[model samples]
Target: MFRVLGALTGTGGPAKLDQEEQSEKILSQAHDFEVALQAMDYVLDDHPGKGLQLLEGSGAKPKNEEDQCVRVLARGVIEFLEATLGFEASVMKKAAATLSEAQQLSAKRRQQFQKMGLKTSSLYPPGTEYAVTFAEACLLHALLMLFSESMVESAKALFKLRKAYHMLREILNDINAAKKKKGSAMYAQGNNESFASFVSADSSTFKSVDIPYSLSTEEQQNKELMELAENVYNMRKKRLEGAHIGNSPAIERLRTDLGIQALKDLPKKKEAKKPVTLSKAEIDKDQATIDEFIHSGVNLCFGILQVVLSLIPPAIGAVLSVVGFHGSREEGLRLVWRSTKDRNIHGGIGLLGLLFYYDGPFQFTDVDFDVPATSDGLKKTSSNDLDNSTLLHPGKMLEDALLQARALFPNSALWLLQEARMLSSRGRLQEAVDLMDSIDVSGIEMKQVRALMIFDRAMTLVHLHEFERAAEDLLSLLDINEWSHALYTYFAGCCYLENYRMCQMGLMEYSRIDFFKERATTLIFDAPNMLSRKKFMSKNLPLDRFMLRKVEQFKKFQSQLQLQDPLDAIGVSPVHELTYFYNGYNRMTEDCLKLSHKLLTEYHNPTIDAKEPNQELVKNLLTSLTSRRLGKVQEGCDMLDKNVLPQIITLQPDGKVKYIKKTEDPWAYPTALYERALFTWKLKGLDGLEECKMWLTRAQDYADDYELSARIGMKIKAAIDRLEG
Candidate 1:
């Protein structure tokens, strides 16, 4: 592929790279590639063992969903690729059959011309004339539409090897350009907040200063390093026979062609391809890593993808890196997967692995997930409470955050958590949960903040209807040493209460509801702001009125300025506010279809800019939202696609989507289950009616569960009608 790219360069490629050899640069490039090769260097690296035991001494485990996601992704990629290739593990035999049939035909190697396909044989008479055509080549490009994926083995390696080099160059260029424009833009010392972090700030050091010469030199060096990697990679690409299982040679070539010497002193050349400038918005949305991976996968640069993708499973990481398959990843993976031996083979299995696991890398855990900021945010005034708001920071802290969230690195967990919540809400729960779970929470000092984390989980689970499982989340949490966070106590109480309620609902018994309510009152007193929250609320539970009552109560609470835990206090609140804004926009689309109007007045959300919630729900949301949106009625059902139903439950990890976070988050459990249920309800048809009847009783396990009732109610009714029929 490197060679092909080199050939394409055609006298106008890689100028800076044409320059000198420095031992320092060579060592750096080698170090980078070694890291890039972790996923692909299976030859040198031992297979990572599975299970908690292996991870006992290994720090944190990959987590259930992350591990499952990779395996699933490997499987899915294989399936799609096989289907596209018109073969599975045994397609070679079929192709061979055609070759044999071509030999037996006497009409100059033609096989029944009009009915069958292809024209190739050595048995026809020498002078015999048979029409030859290249018609199929047209579709070969289209063939790339199938079986290609970022998860393909080849796709991954190319990505890591090339992408890392590309990103470094890009970052260096940006730094250099920033320095040239602003002056004194170097990273060394004093910039860090902690004095200790300075590691002894030296007056002569490069810290707290930026120099153009140093910046430009850094970019110049990076440019050369990346080009070198691209060149060597392309060199091996030109020799590819086809995309399937046989594309192993190029990987070996990638490993061998670019040695330490080649990286040392390479020649300068012309522009490889004119660089395209993009806006900040565009860059933020671009999944360059994913795009490259897909490209490698489809180009039969399978050896490349295999290596890069090995760093992280494509199923879980593809979306994070690229964004989507149809536009970018599909072509890339298809180019390689379709060209492969078969899906059933090791290669095929690898491809399928790409498909199923890319989105998840997360799984269902016994926990509660909630977002109190959601309820709180709903109560804020129209004057934009995020600005100059003390609910979060004190004095100058608010000022600093305002300057940061809008910038590149916010250094705020709220921002990260908000991102996590949005992903979970979209139904990539596993990914969201994985990210939240992995977050470093030591920086958090507020007890209320800790509770909010628990709330995030409780809400996710409530939506999922994992009644007993959701309730169990509070047990361990309540028993923990640091269970003092107000948000934590509230959510844990909610989870237990909701779980018991769900059990009652499931059993259709009024007694359990009463018992759980009694249990809930006892736990509420333990909440951080329990007395304040219940000061004057109605005696009747809010769940009775659904989301409406909760919305009204929060609104009242906000109006009085009687709130203890400010809405924006957690740092992540503003980000959560953004999510609320988007949901408001999505609601309008829901209004168009009249999906949910049971809440208060028909409020139009200004955030979505009045755009439709799109033609369809996102893949992450599809499975989770389907049952509630589609319903069992035939007329209402016409809006659904049969194939989509199965696809929804197909179980994608957060690893499949572009905007997803790289680590685990606590809010994903319910989100994943909700989506799984969407798929399940649609496929179950008549059986869902039973599940619907018990939804409300089960929803009561949580303190602020008004929203859960609505979600479950919608799905249950729709499910019962569809499945029970």
Candidate 2:
């Protein structure tokens, strides 16, 4: 009968099954599931090629639908990773095709099971597993489509994501319904037994497994068994004492041997174990195996979808909501936390997702922090307060999760990078850099992870004011990946420019100043041209576009002054202005902030007086930022309102129509507005909540069509959400 079922289900041929397993053992669908998990384990261990090889070897010619689905899904994952990391159009196309195939196969299997009225061995209804896999395929495919250059493809991706969202909701509903039914059945069964009988039965069913003696003397084995028996005897004696049962002679003797002084000293009664029949035990084992497989996959995928959708800027999120597509970051984080509880590949991915969110976007974009109460009033005394604040603090959780991941995959460099990021967030800049440097990416096949390590280390160095070394690190990334060459080049240029400023300020040797100046000019001039050559999905990235705009502004400034060097024509440090977007200034040391302030004030005063209104506006904007970070909140606010905001907006005589001022650097206006909002929130606490929102909303409105507008919008949304919450 088993052979015939195997043949009909296409799980395996009769001969193959006979050779693979004993006739008494039933074949399980979990074989392919386990294999897929092992493949992921191999990848996490820094053996990505071996992982792909194993998957291909097992899934090349799958005999069953489940095997085929796992195979195609794994293939799609590899392709998606390559495409995203390398930005290869051809690889992305292949990923799209593979995911589509997986989706169709899962759907077909689900329909076949439903039509045949088949019942799964587990508690879930027939085809439920296939339905979950189908939803996963849909979500992956939608995510891949988002990288497409075509507008139509983007629209289709949104609809597909919506479909997957609804499907996951339905699957969760089915799981809840099944759980309720099982609960009701269990409750009904418990009602049939008397309370005394139930308690006694549960106590009697607590049988311990006997360990077989191996390669040990009989005397030693006997000693171990005797120890185990004594422990069990004492446990039962304590239970009897807690239950207030009359102590028989046997119990009294056992308690006497255990050195019990008084009956009142006995521990409280433990909760009674649930009694299980042999048949029910076997059924539960099967149900639990399948439950882990299904629940982990569903929660991980759903959580990822929610988080990605929640990150969309409000401008785009509002449009998406009009079409019934919405997401909550809080809800997504909760679901991801659930998946992390399971010991599976999905759980690992969910853990990494949380780490990235907290260390990356959450740290970079979130603006809320607790202001220290000084004698005068509330004020932000140190930039370090941003990470130390109690609002949504994830430091403890991050540390615990990183420790767990390191224990599981000691050879993996990815977790080490996350550890370094945690260190950086806690203000240990040098330690973070050291930790990142110690990560050996020699065995890791994924170049993207390598690129990330370099980028992160360079950013930390920037915070440490090691500009020359940071520039070298950023330049090294050009050889690693093609995802964003323009951005890398632009970053290198900014670093060199910063080094030149240091030299001019007598912070470095004056001899290398000319070399740094020339290098900075060359890289900045070349950055724009690199963007035109390196296009992903036939479109420039948002950051790359921002870089191009800055380069254009620099060219115009240089031409107006007819200076041989572009840096000579600038009033404010472009690198410092650019760092504001990345929240780099928020991590600066007191000494670093002072040096930056001096660079802006001493060297830029002449340029500010060069009949350039935009130059003066931007100078004040950056100076205010530096001043605020150095514990001068009121001074920063006064400078912003007095010198920056008035220049950007002039009041009309009628007081009905506001005249807006035009400047070459339009991004500075909205960014200044955002800074003002932060100032209000710090000074007034909850009292100025409405005013803070007003400033943020105006910033968002004015951010339209400006450089880094999307970035500004995201920060504004995060701030507003914090206020409302």
Candidate 3:
């Protein structure tokens, strides 16, 4: 660390200078590329929705690495520079015209791609961060190549320009030395005549790279090994240069050679050598498995210790502490950090510490602990503090707990389940699942225990918006054969939402919907009081309002789901979830109006009051409803279209809108589609009207429901009728 740090700070040896300069050349090339790309990006930005949109005709094809590099390297940098440079009116006009045309052109890509029935987002590997990197790297290569040749070639001219260029060259010298010392692959492969590049703006790239090695044939190995070695050497060389570390010939040579002199030193086994060979992937998996066991053991042990220490005798705890049974002061601190994780280690550690020390004692007893039934072992967690210096470290804490618990109960699922919950809370979802998978919940209603785990996991999935998985888990839980209206209703509502989304996304399955809805209704009607007596506030906030709204929505949707032939027909309702939402909206409005009306007389309209806040939105929706009730559908709709919709887009579910009031827009959320449909109905050349179905599809980005589908379907029918007439 010191050597690397010193070299970086200019205290490195002269030999390191060459490697450092080479790295500097690379870095300089990257900067130049940035400046250049920034310019192009500015041009692109000026024309917002424009550019290389020719999709079906031809995808973006930067034939070689250089072209790809330059394209990406010169992206946002120049654009940002231009933003600072005062854009003129003419420039703005030109940009607008260009972007307008670009947008029009770009639509074709989406159109053709959609017709083929594939996800555009999935065209690139989901969440891959490749495109930006490779492009920049390519550009860096080109820029450095250009600069290096230019510097060595233009060394004389640069000497005349100023001392700044010389200083830059010297800095590059130092950087190059460091890169060579470390043995960069890029540097080894990089021609002294050329520079470097790789700048891409696209989030992902799927370019295939040659695997670099094949031990299948000795002949193939001989040929590929050299290339692979070169690649490795180049990367090492560049890494050293970038860090400004002093160049070391020995290091470079060492990188080039094997432990022994001859090729015999290299392992003879191929990837799957029957006797001993292991692939990198296999090795990684083995290591991970080992780590999992260690983590699990440590956690369980710590949990046992925490419980045991809590019950320790004061004198013994103090004597043990002084005698270093736990660890030295530093060791203790470090162990505390490792132990604070969800080790399910609670009860005794801090209490023991407090008992031992008369002075201010450790506050382990103050730490929050939960004893829960789960698939993983028990978990005792620390709050959000990352240091783990607190009682939350799971390592020792969990280790202690397991030790103590096993002594008392031998083997208990109840304790292990708590462990699983702890793992889930710490973002170790898969780990928690694995831990649960190892459990045997037999004889003691293990199915229900497993079901609970499924529920917890489903909750997490829901948070991540993995609705499909969450729905599946929830359904599994319902299938367990469960009871209670509130529980089943909630699951039913969630299931319906999932199905609605699936249906909207071109899914034609009806049986799935029927099954979920049936389950939901059965659970919902099991107890009438389930809907009324439940307290909505989950964690302090009176969520009763929101929960009620959700329940009301589902109930309404269920009521509207009157099938013509319950036994023979498809049970999927056209607007089940939507019916619920609309129903919920009505219920919430009813409550809101009551509050608003009371305020209208006493508080003279809505004012800022935390306790009894304003209900302007409710009042407005009421007014709209009144107008609609008084035979003003068209008028109310217009008011909703022009006024309410935009505001609702920003309205909080629980918090009322401060500036806007009311629900004049009966079809507020679907206004975008409604207008598009209406425009088509009027024979107006609405923007993207031909792609109305696509617009509807985009609307289902978050979730789906029968209400929206019905509205859209109705609009389509109305437009068809008007067009035919």
lDDT of 3 by residue, 1-725 (tens): 34323332334421232322323222322232222222332222222112212110133332222223333323322222222122222332333333333223223322322333221111121111122222222222222222211222122312222222222233235445646664665334343212222211133311101111111333223333334323323332332221111222211111112112211222332222334221122122111111222232232223322332222222233333543333122223333334322111111222222222211111122111111223133232344222322222334444343333222222334334444444444434455556555644343223434555565555544433345566566556545432322443454455454444344333436646666445444433342345454322111111222334434543443444543322111122212222222221122233333332332223321121211211233333334443433434455446544554455345358854323332322233343333333323223233434544333332322112222232233333323322221
- Tens digits of per-residue lDDT for model 1, 1-725: 33222322323233222112321222232222222222222211112222112223233222222122222222222222323322222332332333223223312222222122211111111111111111111112222321222123223333333432332233335435645654442222223221111111232221101110122334334544444433323322221121211233221121111112321222211122323222222122111121122222333433323322322222233343562221122223333333232211222223323322221112111011111233323243335222212221122322222122212112334334443454453454555555556655555432233444544554444444333344455444544322223333444445445444344435335656666555554443345343233211122222222222322333443455443532211111111221221232122233322322221112222211222222122222332233344343332233233422232233247633222221111122223333343433344533653543333122211112222322232233322222222
Best by TM-score: 2
lDDT of 2 by residue, 1-725 (tens): 45634643555432332322221111234445545555665555455676688777844344544446766766666666556545655667787898889888788767655654443423456567778778888887887776443344555677888878888888889877877876765323333221011011232232111111111333223433334333433433322222111222212111111111221232221122223111121122112333455777788888888866765555555457766867765556667766776655676778877776666623623534443323233233345232223224555655665555554555566767777776666666787787776656555567766777787888888778788888898888888766568888888888898788788778789999989988898887798888777776677766787788778877777787777756776667777776676566676778878887887787642344585777778888989988988889889999999998887666468753242646477668877887889888777877787989878777766665444555566667666655554
For lDDT, the strongest prediction is 2
Ranking by lDDT: 2, 3, 1
Query: Residue 306 CA error for candidate 2 (Å)?
Result: 3.0
TM-score against truth, every candidate: 0.24, 0.76, 0.24
| Segments in model 3 whose C-alpha atoms lie over 4 Å from true places | 1-410, 426-431, 440-454, 460-485, 507-546, 553-725
**lDDT for every model?**
0.29, 0.63, 0.31
Between candidates 1 and 2, which one is better according to TM-score?
Answer: 2
* lDDT pick, better of 1 and 2: 2
- Better model by TM-score, 2 or 3? 2
